[model samples]
Target chain A: MELFSIILLLVMGVATIGSAILALTTKKTDVAILAAGAISLFASIFFLVLASPDVAMTEAAIGAGLSTFLFFVILRKTEQNAEK
Target chain B: MLLSIENIALASGILLILIGLLGALTNKNIIRMIVAFSIFDTGVNILIVTFGYMPGRTAPIIDGAKVTAQNIAQVAIDPVPQALVLTAIVIGFGVTALMLVFALKMHEKRKSLDINDYTDLKW
Candidate 1:
């Protein structure tokens, strides 16, 4: 069980780090928002594997679900051509 | 086994903190930064739970069997982390909701989601 948890956590850690890097480097708002959501999901999984189910669920809901929705809503409301 | 478990827990906690800091520092998107902040919180919660674990312990809740003081102290898991995680969850919700509102307001004013475009306060 410990080994399984450790491996899951390491995988989650990599996914999170990758997503954060991608979120920063991506030029498109939609892509960045999606990356951010993905990172949140992975982080939530890490929380669960580390034995904090409550935090995992909250991160899944508020961080990944609602926040992503909010980002997309904002993205749709704003113009995408201002940066060029 | 005990030493390895402690090492794993420590590594996981450190990894979470590092990821959160990286997200906050490098990510310019407001939503991304919020997510990173939440990640950091989750890491700390995990650490709390990790401390609650013991080699041969039952759940924190008490039942009819073996409810003595020493048994309660020895066998029961710590309930503090569970409580702390609950509070963190509520706070995370409030912060996310506020961030959403701010994102909307910024959208209404600036007409763009790009952080670079919101340069009105820039000197």
Candidate 2:
């Protein structure tokens, strides 16, 4: 079980780093936003694996859901303003 | 030979912090920087949780049946970091939202997302 947990943790770490890199390097702001949110989601899972379910739920709800939606709203508003 | 889970978690947390710092530093766009900041925030939270972990320990919940007064500390992980992370997560969300609003207002005033463009306040 420890070995399995270690493997999962390593995998999650890689995924988190990969998504963060994508968020940084991506040209499109929307894609970057999504990738950033993915980092949060993955981190939430990491939190769960570390025996912190409360933090995991909070991360999922705020980091992935609320933050992503807020970013989208800001993006839309900015784009619309730019068009005008 | 495999490294211990604690070492693994710590290394990963450090890597995440470095990655976030790199992203935050290299990004030119306002929104991208804010996204990078969130990444950094998540890394910090992970580090805090990882630091609180104990090998072979369960969650910090107290059921009063399985986890009694005598063995609670031995069976459960630390709760302080979890509580700290909970507050940090909410605070991070609030700060990120405020940053996004600031970005919006900046765009409204300058019609650009590039941080370099906001040089009026710079000396």
Which parts of model 2 are misplaced by more than 4 Å?
Answer: none
Task: List, in order, the clash count of every candidate structure.
Answer: 0, 0
Residue range B1-123, candidate 1, lDDT tens digits: 544544566666667677777777776776666656755765675567677665445555556686555578776666787678768767866776677678767867766555788877999
- TM-score for candidate 2 (chain B): 0.91
Q: Pick by DockQ: which candidate is best?
A: 2
Q: How much does candidate 1 score in TM-score?
A: 0.69
lDDT per residue for candidate 2 within B1-123, as digits (tens), equals 356677777777787788889988988999989998988899899999999988878788888888777898789999999999999999999999999999999999999999999888899
Query: What local distance difference test score does each model get?
Result: 0.67, 0.89
User: Candidate 1 overall Cα lDDT vs. reference?
Assistant: 0.67
lDDT by residue (tens digit), candidate 2, A3-78: 8888888888888888888887888999999998998998888888888899999999999999999999999999
**Candidate number achieving the greatest lDDT relative to the actual structure:** 2
> Chain A vs. true chain A, TM-score per candidate?
0.89, 0.95
Residue pairs that clash (backbone atoms under 3 angstroms), model 1: none
